[model samples]
Target: MGFSKLFIFLFILQTLLAMALTQPTDQKTNIFREYIGSVSNNVTFADVPINPNVEFHYILAFAIDYTTSSSPHPTDGKFDVFWDTHNFSPSEVTAIKNQHSNVKVALSLGGDSVKKEKCYFSPFSVDSWVSNAVSSLTKIIKEYNLDGIDIDYEQFHADPEIFAKCIGKLITTLKNNGVISFASIAPFDDDEVQSHYLALWKSYGDIIDYVNFQFYAYDKGTTVYQFMNYFHMQSSNYEGGNILVSLTTEGRGGLSPENGFFKACDMLKSEGKLNGIFVWSADTSKGLGFRYEEQSQALLAVSHLHSLV
Candidate 1:
């Protein structure tokens, strides 16, 4: 082969190799999985392995607890970050990230258990629970080379004002320190979490990178119109970048991946109103055979390609 032809062939080979190694980010699809609640029976992290064909913007680890009055984190600003291996393990995390080199391995903080007042909006405090949560979060992000943090504070009943302050300050700190590339919230269709987020966005929306808004759990019998309508309603509160259309696996049924769920996603993608899809869980879905892990990426990819045309 001539030198010029040889150069072209080598370049093509290198490009193909790069594609096999990592996922493309720009003008591509975004899919996320939340490792929350419980994984399916006998389904270990290795059970539902990362599909090389799929690319994920985030694979959120279900959660880490906050230092509460009952279960305090650490006063000396040290946090273990991991325990009860069921939630996560080091090797499992590595495997997930290795699939998509740019995949953001984020940690979800809080759930039904995290107490606000008891922890002073923990992630924002210092030398106390703040130290505990932040220090631990720092440790994990570095240790695992994780990407970001997602706040899944389920206690919307708490003061939205306090919640907003905590959220605003926390994201600001995380982004400023360059410890996390993104920060997100997992909120539902109610005014509880919404109110707090609204308060935060009123002044500090820039700090928030995404909102994995839960479309299931609360919204029963969700139709395509209902799903789009919710997007319209929520998008008013946040920007296009912050809104991620999320669905459930083990919800009140009907609103599933193969059910009306993908239908809703299709409409959103067509209208260009979707950031991406967020599955409420990984394990439960795997157990129930509610698999859309690869489909989510494929759907988004098709949607994106159509938008270009």
Candidate 2:
């Protein structure tokens, strides 16, 4: 071959090698397969009937309340699931996973702490929470055969480093466990949460799957511009892959499906940055033709090539 031809061949070879060296979607498969939703922990799996029509890749069990500190720490694998904490089974997870082959169901830690202070606050700082909670959390994930853990420890005091460190360790350890397929952190469009979580996302983002940002329940992020900005900021932190944008399904959100939510969804989908949509609840939208879940899924169903390279 001539000199120019040989040079072109070498350039192509090097580019292919570089692409090969890069990791999968986020050190794993592409998380943005279809869509994602959350089933509120307020009711048991039995309470909410599954809609055969709706499809989602992930469905996070809304939350688990932290009651007391026992051996292995963090409520001893016993979760306040559904309505009541008493009487539960790991089979619940199996049954849910059995519902959808692609759907991953993981237990979320912490929810709105209106009645209680926080399941993750108080004596447990980032270090303490991770150290103490690891054993029991591991036991739960393994025994339950659950997909992964969702870190929603929102009642943080002043320590962002500990929070991120604790989360980073949890993701690393859980990923090491092998059963935990995915782990996610819940942050909102706030300085405190975003700054701390950005630390984790920047450093150990490869280990985690999605940053399930609570785009509602906050004062701001009501308009299309606001919503776009919120998603943009969250997406900025996560340079790995698509970040899941969760909005309130019930009347909890300020943005309307006919307005801001739809506009943002379209823009994100077109950009190929949209991962999926997560609705705050199943309880409110499951029955009586509420259509909250249905509408959100439809808006997120925007399609584009995963890679044009």
Candidate 3:
């Protein structure tokens, strides 16, 4: 009887150990991201304070697949640097990453506009566009020493399937070729945009890392209650993806930080649903002394510590 009891005890101990090892730990992946150099206000990585406790990413505003000229036009899938390269160059990226071991730099693709014209996906064909995009973006990613890519195409001339295939293939190729370690999709709540991104999410949700939903693109004066509802909606739409909370430094729209944005975040964190926070444009933030940026990092840092305990 004692031998049988000892055997049972050992089995129970092993099962308990496995359960403990498998429990989820989210503290390591908590992140704080910001977009910079989009407005050309001379904002560099050094201008933003880096918090050592949180995983921080500096997204270079845009590397649009368009020609650079007085009147820019799309070049099928070829990308050119549209951000403030003089202020945020390859050397600067290296310097910042070297300075902060937790820092990573990624480039955004297909922003809202290029030289006043609406930027569209406008790919000739999925195969050709993927080919050109892979080649051109590989060059730019290498040149900038970037770690990832964020899709921010605001408009699309192509159909939803075409957009999905083109982007899904591009991200797959980049990851397989070891070009990028992470990829994200930025989609707001517009009907057309939703259709296209939802198609992509359905097909490639396993590969995409974060849904940087433009929460700030919503109407101004959003209440904390409404914000929480919207968060649940997008979380359901994207399903298992990490839906990050956002606010623009421009205060152009969405839930303003001064008006209880952090309070909503606290609620999500308490529920273990808060993934991360991203701010729009570090350019406008410089004038505000980056108070919101500091607050965001501090929140993530504190949450990380709490998770450890």
Candidate 4:
């Protein structure tokens, strides 16, 4: 071939290569973009095996303990209260990032056993609490490069109006600062709670990205199926797809993933209300030394269903 022809061919090949390089690879998916995934079943610096085929969209790490009293220590006394990003070095965060590149890591703030007083009490009086939370969250995100924040405050009944307003403000502030914000709320079977709070959440839907409904811990007065039916019935009224339903496998008043959780997901999917599933905490179900294999299997089952769909 002539030298000019060879040069032209090389230029075309280089252009093709440049285009391929600019395109995103399948492994490095978008993080800020919404997707389905599991909550981190093991929050500690342990070897947690994540399914490669199933994209782990969100992995929530436990940070501050907003509970009223001191948290309970395991037999080893490893994960005590006051455990946050400060306790875990940069290496721990790096380990999680390495495991799942597409995962959005959000730091959770409260737990079910938390005392109402320890929560944001100024929700009724001052708006500074929102600023304080935003400041702390921004610091954490800057430090660890997290994707967003998850508000796990369990004191929903203390001051619903002020609490919702504070949440709306916090979410708006976070979004304005280029961060995503989500809240975990209690599930309702009757219209009593929903009548008051559901409207508030709907009104502020533009600010809040998603809401993880705690469908467990409800009164299992009847069979598990009956309880799940009641939960589904309540969720029917609210906007469906944006809601994430969480199930607990082991706790004082918990439901097994096999019976309550899987069934609940199936029910939601049938009604076109299922968005995703989030386990309560890594320590409670899989992190602690009990029923690890069972929880793993349950998670695998969910992942498998996602694959088929």
The most accurate candidate by TM-score is 3
- Per-residue C-alpha lDDT of model 1 across residues 114-194, encoded as one tens digit per residue: 223322233334324444556567777777677788876655434676667655666777678899987777777666667
Against the true structure, candidate 3 has what lDDT? 0.88
lDDT (0 to 1) per candidate: 0.61, 0.57, 0.88, 0.48
Error of 3 at 147 (Å): 0.0
Per-residue alpha-carbon lDDT of candidate 2 for residues 1-309, written as tens digits (9 for 90 to 100)? 999999998998777555533322221223332112333334455444333323344344434535545532234223454333221356666776686544455777765452344444333455655656666667766776767777765655546666667668867877776758777777776776677777777778888777777777566338888877767766766776447766665666656675567677778767766666666665555453536555554343323122313
Deviation in Å, model 2, residue 160 alpha carbon = 1.1
* Residue pairs clashing, model 2: none
Better of 3 and 4 by lDDT: 3
Per-residue CA lDDT of candidate 4, range 149-239, in tens?
Answer: 6655543443566656766676677778786534444334435455435655766755555555556556432345765665566556555
The candidate scoring highest on lDDT is 3
Off by over 4 Å in 2: 1-65, 68-89, 120-128, 287-290, 299-309
Runs off by more than 4 Å, candidate 4: 1-46, 57-81, 84-87, 113-120, 156-158, 181-199, 220-224, 258-260, 287-309
RMSD of each: 5.6, 8.0, 5.7, 9.6
User: Which pairs, if any, clash in model 4?
Assistant: 67-114, 68-115
